[model samples]
Target chain A: MDSEYLGYAAGILTTVAFLPQAMQLIRTRQARDISLTWAATMTAGVFFWLCYGVAKQSVPMISANGITLLLLLVILFIKLRYQDSTDTGEK
Target chain B: MDSEYLGYAAGILTTVAFLPQAMQLIRTRQARDISLTWAATMTAGVFFWLCYGVAKQSVPMISANGITLLLLLVILFIKLRYQDSTDTGEK
Candidate 1:
């Protein structure tokens, strides 16, 4: 297989990995168990990957990280929102 | 900054992202909320990245993916173990 194809394959696999967790969290409205630190760190990491992708002009990295970053952001938002509710006993 | 440095930087950021979650899971023995699908998918994805790294002979990719794969495997193990105990009441 071509190197580019391999890169895309890897990207797709990793990028899609977040979907199940994100969907489950959205469906169940449960984010208290999810670590905010993990979400935040992963988001920052994905952002760096996006920057690296742009620097290298790599389509796979740019596209994959772009979508992954969005997903992580949503997760982060849910985590924070639910955490706040739990902490304040508002939920 | 050099492109190589950017790749390493990206790798480090993304790779280290898992540590917080892993440590939390280990310290708290809580894996009930972690999606098995996510763990499985990510493990597979990191494996592909490892393969891609080998094919491309990229040091950063190889090193980062290698370590990430191990961490994901541990996470998968914890998820499975806890999930089984929860299901069977063995824990």
Candidate 2:
């Protein structure tokens, strides 16, 4: 019932939400078809969330967004790298 | 400087972040490598965020997560369907 607990719960839940996509991307190493617009948008959202968390000094927000950002970054990188390679026909 | 503007800014940013990924997935119609676990986890997070938003009566949180939940649902559905089709080998 505590606010802290509530925030933590939210953090954990949201973090896990990203797991399915993250795991899939990591395993396959293919991100060519994913939407550049969508990923870019989400990254912006996470960045704002991180900033908001900092501004509000909300630990839950900070932790959750930080981790989400990292996960997203990985996905984004895979997507870009895959596209780059495919375009170059390196693999 | 208003809180409303700040919240909206965050929402837009995060939403845009997901743009790239969403676009890629939609264009290629490929969700084979995405992880079920990660998607489930992200769903949970969004669910909690929705709950928290409701409890707190935070319009910004509610709006952002509501849209996010919908987007994620689409991705999840595509992934499942793709797997099902691949399993059946009808395509």
Candidate 3:
């Protein structure tokens, strides 16, 4: 029961944490510091977490990972946009 | 069985994702794009995840969250150091 609370709390915290980062990218329009590798890996990772949640039938995980995956996709989209527009490299 | 593999893969990818960001920070020494809010929130979230892992007794969660926590702390520490030297403002 306690661990369930902890899981939910942890999931909520981690899930919401990306909001500011996504907002920051929008606000500053700076993706120079955000590595392409990082975004790609996180996207894959979060996607898998979502699958894990679905397989395990865990609501907190499903919701948390789902929301965060969406946020991460936004982040990746923004980062790539910036990359394509400004920076010139493999990225 | 399949989901277990997915879980580990997810954990590993997410855990290692921070590496590039950390390396970028180290290489560029640029904290301008790095947000204090992002760092702080992520740190708190990851710390909670670590607690959750301990509660759940999941090796993948524990190891992944633990290593990522250290990397995040490093990211936060470096960001703070840069903030102190170069920038002035709350957070």
Candidate 4:
């Protein structure tokens, strides 16, 4: 297969892979085993990746990381909400 | 900053990001809230990414994804081990 095809495949698969995680969190409504540090770290990492893509002018990286960033942010948001929901429930 | 630096930063940060996740799983000794599907999907995706790296002859991609694939495989192994541990505990 062409290298471009490989890049596309990698981009699509990796980008789509994050969906299961986000969906699982949403469906289960639990992230007890997931480290907040991991979520935050993944967000920061992917942000740089997106910026890297922009610098390289690679559409696949830019598009994939762009979507992945949004997904990670949603995951982060949910995690933050769930983490504090109990503490704030009484208020 | 150079695009090379951006690539390096993205590669380094993203590669290091998985360590916390693996550490979290090991420390907690629990995978209850983690999605088996996510673990599996991530492994497969990273495998393709590694292949993409090889095809492109990109040292950063190769090095980063290689480490990520190993980490993900470890995670998948643990998730598999945990998911069935109770059922198999009877033996």
Candidate 5:
């Protein structure tokens, strides 16, 4: 396969990986164990990656980051919503 | 800034975002709340990403995926290690 295909395969794998967590969170409404910092930082990071993809004109990067950004935002929102109730006092 | 710089910045942000979770996992020895499916799938996905980076000869992708893969592995290991003890019964 071509390198571009490889990139897309990799992107698909990474992007799909988030689905299980997102679905679980949506179903259970539990975000106590997840790190807020990780979610927030990842959201920012993915946003930058979307920008990078635009700059590079790479479809794989753009598509993957776009979807991943939405996933991260979902996780982040869950984290924030449940933040008060599920305090582990770690952060 | 150059597009390359944007790529690097994006890579850095995403890579660093994993640290907080990793650190917290190490400190608390708690993996009950983390999704095993997420960690395992992410590890596999990141491994593919490293391969993709190698194929593309992209320094940022290689470096970022390399570190992220290791971090995922750490999380996976923790999840597996504590899998029996802290069963949330959600799996």
Candidate 6:
């Protein structure tokens, strides 16, 4: 197999690996326990990863991390939005 | 920056990215809408990615994906356990 194929497989694996959490949060609308600090740090890291991918001209890395970043951001946003009123003390 | 440091940064970012969701679910004990199929596929993908990381001797990839796999697994397990029993129409 070619290196691109391997990269594609890696991209798919890493990107899709986050689907369950994203789907669950979206479906349930529950975001009380998510932490701002953790989310912020992760988001920053993802952004950097995206830049790294771009710097390396690696489409697989860019695409996969990009999609994963978007998915993760939504949950982070929801957590920020409803964390205070959820009464779950999750934040 | 050194390659090792770069890899370490990537690992930190990716590994901790899922913290919010994990913390939330564990705090709320709620897992009503997570899809078994999605979770299963993602878990499998993570496993493959882990193997890929290992084969490449990429500690950054391995460590990051490994931690992510654990976090995702916990959420998936909780979702499976209560997915059928919960009545939120999420599953």
Higher-scoring candidate on TM-score, 1 or 5: 5
lDDT digits (tens) for residues A5-42 of candidate 6 = 55457668657755766676676676443456666777
Selected candidate, larger lDDT, 3 vs 4 = 3
Q: Is candidate 2 or candidate 5 better by TM-score?
A: 5
Cα deviation at A11, candidate 1, in Å, is 1.0
| TM-score, per-candidate, Cα-based | 0.85, 0.76, 0.87, 0.86, 0.87, 0.70
Q: Write the per-residue lDDT of candidate 2 for residues A1-91, one digit (tens) a residue.
A: 6554555787887775566576667776765545656666677777777878887888877888898888888777777776543322121
DockQ of all candidate complexes: 0.46, 0.48, 0.51, 0.44, 0.59, 0.33
Tens-place lDDT digits, model 2, residues B1-91: 5554655787777654544555555665666555666666676777787878887888877887888788777777777766443322112
Q: Write the per-residue lDDT of candidate 4 for residues A1-91, one digit (tens) a residue.
A: 6777776777787788788888877876666667788889889989998999898898878999999999889788878877543321111
Q: How does residue B11 of candidate 5 score in lDDT?
A: 86
Docking class of 2: acceptable
Every candidate's CA RMSD: 4.2, 4.5, 4.0, 5.1, 2.7, 4.0
lDDT of 1 at B38: 89
Q: Give candidate 4's root-mean-square deviation (CA, Å).
A: 5.1
Stretches of model 5 off by over 4 angstroms after superposition:
A86-91, B87-91
> What fraction of the true Cα-Cα contacts (under 8 Å, chains A to B) does candidate 2 also have?
0.61
- Model 5 agreement with the true structure over B1-91: per-residue lDDT tens digits: 7887777778898899889998878877766657788898888888888989999898878999999999988889987986566433344
Candidate order by decreasing lDDT: 3, 5, 1, 4, 2, 6
Q: Which stretches of candidate 3 lie over 4 Å from their true place?
A: A84-91, B84-91
Model 4 residue B17 lDDT score:
81
lDDT for model 1, please. 0.79
Better model by lDDT: candidate 5 vs candidate 6: 5
**Which scores higher on TM-score, 3 or 6?**
3
Better of 1 and 2 by TM-score: 1
> Among all windows of ten consecutive residues in candidate 5 chain A, which has the lowest summed lDDT?
A82-91
Cα lDDT for residue A34, model 5?
Answer: 80
- What range of 10 consecutive residues in model 2 chain A has the weakest lDDT sum? A82-91
